[model samples]
Target: MTAVPEEQPAWRQRAVERSTRAAKLRAEQRVQRFLDAAQELIAEKRTTDFTVQEVVDRSKQSLRSFYQHFDGKHELLLALFEDALSKSAAEIRETAGSQSDPLQALRLAVEMLFEQSLSNPGVERPLFSDFALQLLVKHPAQVATAHLPLHQVFTELVEQAEDAGVIPAGKPRRQASILMQTVMFVAQGNGVPAGSHAAAVSAEEVWQFCLGGLSGVPVRN
Candidate 1:
């Protein structure tokens, strides 16, 4: 007959559970510290060229600690990219929700995205150009997963607008996706130098164009 293992005493079991929870909390704190450090470096340098050792040094954590949480710099960047997009989505959702009209809400969301790109070019530019672009080329699936939150919010607003007859009766999800892509393309180009061959487009103009496209009405300046 196989022998059965003895169960731990109640007090010992409780102590072990508490210890496990504490360890998990500490691990999470360590990861946050590393992430914060990397984000700070990216903002300060206006680029993603910082090294893993730099992150370790900034976080005041050992290389071993960083490796314990992340495999490499690419993994860390991916984590930061996902976190940033998720937070952006939340902010857009909250801001858009404040408006009673669905069309106005969608417009506000688009304006907010453009404003962020213009106002925070240092951070947003590098993130999209250096990290997001590369991720799109190499790991498209990951990009889609990270972008889902923002896309979902846009889809909800589009659906609301369609139901209200503010927009044409068509594919709300497709419309939302197009709106997102158009806004992103414009926002990404906002960093172009003033003297570049590309003509500068104002945020209001972009919004008007989008509104016209959805309503199937010509927008008059």
Candidate 2:
């Protein structure tokens, strides 16, 4: 019988590549744990007062591992903002998928996003609130980079709707940006004056108005 040949070089290279990928995934998971822990802490206290050490303890991860993923607490907050935006976008996409009409899907996405902000108390105030947004304004690079994923999702949905003839041809990205900015204020309750008799418009109403403008459909009262 012929002797079996030793493992091929390409095979060894592939094995090393797989090992590297596994290590990368594990590192990401650890980083995500820290963000999740931070969110939980904010929820518990309804504020961003917790220390990095407390986040590390909540994550059950070593300080060394935390440093490996993020430079400092501020960087970690940037990561948290990015992660929350991405998660919110994903959920909106999932809910919007149930609709057959592309225009309705776009509206559904907006409704779902607003509902998510309302469902999580800390979410609205921590990341998307006007007060929080002002703090991030100085870090334009970080904010722009972190917000790109959510922007992409919103822009894509609008483009698809227009392409499907669900809405008239217009500047999809511009529309998406305007819609996103407007919804944040609406969700943060900024539009309603405190102790006023004015009725704040619902997310559905906002969506209908947007649809009316884009598709020339009449807005329902």
**Candidates' lDDT values, in order?**
0.83, 0.75
Q: Model 2: which residue pairs collide?
A: none
Q: TM-score, each model?
A: 0.85, 0.78
**Candidate 1 residue runs with Cα over 4 Å from true position:** 1-16, 119-127, 191-199, 219-221
- TM for candidate 2 is 0.78
- Per-residue lDDT for 63 in model 1? 99
Compute the lDDT of residue 216 as modeled in candidate 2: 74
Output the number of the TM-score-best candidate.
Answer: 1
lDDT of 2 by residue, 101-213 (tens): 88778888877666655434465332535225654676778777776776777898899898997788899888888877677656667356767646766778767766777
By lDDT, the best candidate is 1
